[model samples]
Target chain A: MLSVNRINTYRIPFTFEYYRPRTLREALEILRSVEGAKVVAGGTDLVVDMKFRRVEPKALVDVSKLEELRYVRLVEDYVEIGSAVTLQELVESEVVRARLPLLWEAVNSMASWQVRNIATIGGNICNASPAADTAPPLLAYGAKLLLTSLDGVREVGIGEFFVGPKRSIIRPDEVLQAIRVPVHPAGYGWSFRKVSRTSFDIAKISVAVLLKVDGGRIRDPRIALGAVAPTPVRARSTERAIESLSLEEALEVGPRFVEGDIAPIDDVRSTAWYRREVAKVLLRDSLRTAYERSLNPGWVHEG
Target chain B: MRVRLRVNGSWVEVDVEPHETLLNVLRDRLRIRSVKYGCGIGECGSCTVLLNGRPVTSCLVLAAGLDGTSIETADYLAKTELGTRIVNALLLEGAIQCGYCIPGFLVTIYAALKSGMIRRGDSTEIARAISGNICRCTGYINIVKAVRRVVAELVAIGAD
Candidate 1:
């Protein structure tokens, strides 16, 4: 049995250099110079992993104080979210709650209120966990990640950003500055579904769907699933299979198409069979909700 | 690293290692024992504290990152009128069984009531607000009752 004192024993059991850069330039310089420097925005995930010895960087660049990386703007065709914006800020934003209900749902279900207060979207994306709750929604929305460094800035499509589980294409010196999410067109319906061990737990399987309906036929359907693959992936085959179909007809063929898109595996959270079954149900449920919501946008706001 | 922060309304500076968590600094250096350490990971909310007026698990917060922030723990809240009201309600509801989780729950309840996200007698809101906190002893029934009672009292008195 672990002693009581051991509960807080790892609370700084090791030592490493720390840097708090006031400006983005300074942070980038430190990252560029240091061999094993990690940027800590919220430190919610990084700190815990460090305590568990899962990661041990030579230095930590604290960027939570960089005021430049904090804003939420609705531009002409996109919603630009500063990567440092906490999940709590996302939940509190009326624009997010109204204009991007799918993203809002995904963020709201990601973590508890307390954790949400400190966890940032940048950290969530940079962690690149297959079970990341925000990934599917962002993938469905076709978001883009803004990566900045001493060199300059570049934008990577969200789909291309995540390479695999616990890994991404993020350069060692680059910092994710903001997430640019395309605003959904009017008359589009979207839904997000997550199956977790508990209400506040990480997801075993999650799905996000966005589609438009005209004349009782689906159009431009998009589907994304998380935790069932190495990276959150768009269900292209599933979307193609259900295009131009009525809600009833789509539901009939959706589950089979989903099986082709996702590759589930046994894990501590759930069995591969359970994930496949739940993924099918979630796909159907999200499709039904999206279909119903397409008929009435105001219905999306309803409880 | 030399870090400075306002803890419980007092500005203090301490040298903390890069790996040190805010929980370690609070309990070890500042001697704030009310912030209990249940699970070092963020799963358990035993080390919850208010960072810049928002409740967060201090165990997950790096002390080095809190260089210029403000933190409030349960011990700090116990002095306020709202904190006293919550404590009385907890007592009335018999929420504290083993008392291991009381400090964390009290801090969480205080933040919830103060944030205005929850209203009086809304058990659903109360539960949602504190869902991150794990209370093994009481099964959360009495704790929910206690929070509701405090909310009702605050509402009746017109305390915003």
Candidate 2:
């Protein structure tokens, strides 16, 4: 028999309420009425944190049953992903793999298959961990977050949605409804690299690079880094430095520029010095790989 | 909270704490002791069960969330002909060992087999499908052998 820990009884702070809302309107009403209500999608991250007493909300509004927030569609120039969609769904989605391969790559490299089955993209973004796997790719893809509350709907850039570690601009009453990823035209190349102790370890440092090249000169470039800052950040300095550089010159200068932009901390996963060094390495490698794949489209593999 | 679920083709209703894990509810409330609790977390696959035809870690699944869902435990394996063949092969091949992890292994393999995830006559596919499950005693040699035997039987019976 497994050793059962003695159950401890604490005085009820108050009888917290649990509400299961099946529709978007019902969910919004519950979130608007409850003072400290939380929206539970897959409960992969929330329930674990609650069990450890890290988070205690007055009410939990289960939104896993909301079918409206569980789809992936390509509309106009963007691929809109519903917030309640599971990581597993994203990883296995044929449309996601076809249109947004980098997003598929990042999601596949996250927690094991079982966790992916229950972890939702919205929960991942809402949890707002600095090491979130989906953020860098989404940011690189120029994704827009769609948030909804009883008041109305609002959209925010993925980069601006995250304010700090374990924090976002989302209000207590607002729930993330969808992620809109702008579709890059053909010939745009992308790469995502996550360095960790093991394949399953939370990213020590992750880098995403997107490049579009025309006639061997950079047409457009975007770079994002995670786990090396308070929030996943676009490396504007590094991106600007390589904006006009040739593919060869960009390869040489990208790492040096990236090394100067990040502010990493020494944590249990890695030291500041190591993270910075790996950040440079990953940035250079991902840039080179993305550039090569962009110029040679046939080399890119579909996930 | 009182939750009702279809377990192994039978309706089971039990009252459980809102926070109680599905693993706890299965073993404690339903007396489905076959689902062992190893590592209480999802890391160890000893508490695996089929939820709506997919193998999921029952430890991380809350009982409240499983209301009205179809759950399959190891005890149900004997009801199907293919399941009985696999179970018989396991016994004949001496894959039992400590037996604590057998139930989860059985359920995981059953789901994999029924889903056509592990095609007949493919031992590598069978091994990869059940790689999530950890068996401390068997060292997996006999377990793989038993699975291979079942694969062969499945091929001969045209049950692919």
Candidate 3:
């Protein structure tokens, strides 16, 4: 039984030291040395959870103060987005807006502008929610997660990062350092669609598509869906179905392929049946829109 | 834990628990009740305050984490000339009903006006700027009227 004396309505029971390290090495060392410590980047997610009694960490290592981790750099063949970079920063960045427009689109459709100002890209991915807005677009872009620990740093494919809903392959002592996305060729066109109960609410079903097309024949296609399964998933079957088809034919077959790819569950916001149906509809619409834009980039400005 | 911050243009030193929120520190310790605790969560903008000149929900912000940051609450605006004009307009327009949400609305609009995001005499821009704050009283008609009146006054002063 939970102890009544141990619980406080206004504060947490346990008191631990709070450390705001100036450097990444100092922060990582504190995280490794302190037991049950949580790394706080932006604190948009962790602080809310802590206030609501959802998560209680023994110590909080504030990583937002580390200026070195807050950067967006374009390397040789990939764009490296530091984990501490805020969603608003990512959305407004000329590099991200010009190079990765799909990510910008996804970031724009996320929570309100005020929330996005403080919510970090790393927090969204680290939270590991299936409905995370940034995941589907990043996965579709073939991004890789950079994880660092006291031992060493390693990269993992974004698709394989999530083990389940609200769970990831990241170790307790490891932190997400950065996300590296391979630069796409100039001809790639992308689109992101989200179906939510309200414009600002969480998504019921979302879809992202990145395709390289020449005269309506698909050269390469990538599709990812969110809020339909326990984790964001690539609809490879849907990609295969529309690989050799024209834009119009692909739209017709896209819904059928998506219907078979996702397994949704009934939740408070929506039922499994409604989610599946919307997933199919969004997948079809997103593919059609992406294909049309790829054929004629000028269509984006037309109404 | 002890956290010292600049509040309402004044440096305040307060000792708060590790789990204390900025809202708690502002109201309980500093005795600035203007920032109300309606929801005790980020959903309600009642606890909104300006952290480094950007509007953020204070209930979600940790007081310990806000060290070395500047915070501005609705009360700080009462000292400004533009703020005085807007308050008078709000009172004249009967925009205050229960007065629970007035502080949040005032702080948000003050920041928006000071930022020059909404030009003087632009009602639509003012409305869009304050869209994030929800007010349950006066049906928002009088609130819009109050903002427009203040904006018109500011524009007239600029002409002077």
Q: Which residues of candidate 3, in runs, are more than 4 Å off? A: A1-15, A296-303, B85-95, B116-131, B138-160
Answer with 2 or 3, whichever has the higher lDDT: 2
User: Highest TM-score: which candidate?
Assistant: 1
Chain B of model 1: TM-score?
0.97
What is candidate 1's CAPRI-style docking category based on DockQ? medium
Colliding residue pairs in candidate 3: none
Ranking by DockQ: 1, 3, 2
What TM-score would chain B receive for each of the candidates shown?
0.97, 0.93, 0.91
Per-residue C-alpha lDDT of model 3 across residues A51-153, encoded as one tens digit per residue: 5568878898887767777999899878899998988788768778777778878887787545665678998999988999999999998899999988989
What TM-score, over all chains together, does every model reach?
A: 0.97, 0.87, 0.89
**Tens digits of per-residue lDDT for model 3 on B29-147?**
99999997766555557877888887777876778877888998888876688778878999999999999988988887777777765665466577656665678767788988888
lDDT tens digits, residue span B1-160, model 1: 8989999999999998777788889989889999988877777788889999999988888888787889999988988999999999999999999998889888888988888867656777887899989989999999999888887787788787
Clashing residue pairs, backbone N/CA/C < 3 A, model 2: none
Global lDDT scores for all candidate models: 0.88, 0.81, 0.81
What's model 1's TM-score? 0.97
* Candidate 1 C-alpha lDDT tens digits along A1-303: 867555343475578999999899999999999999998898778877777678888898988778878888899888999889999999888778877889998888878888999899889999999988899999999999999999999999999988888899999999999999988778999899998988889999999999999999999999999999999999999999999999999999999999999888898999999999999999999999999989996664522
Give the DockQ (2 decimals) of all models.
Answer: 0.72, 0.28, 0.42
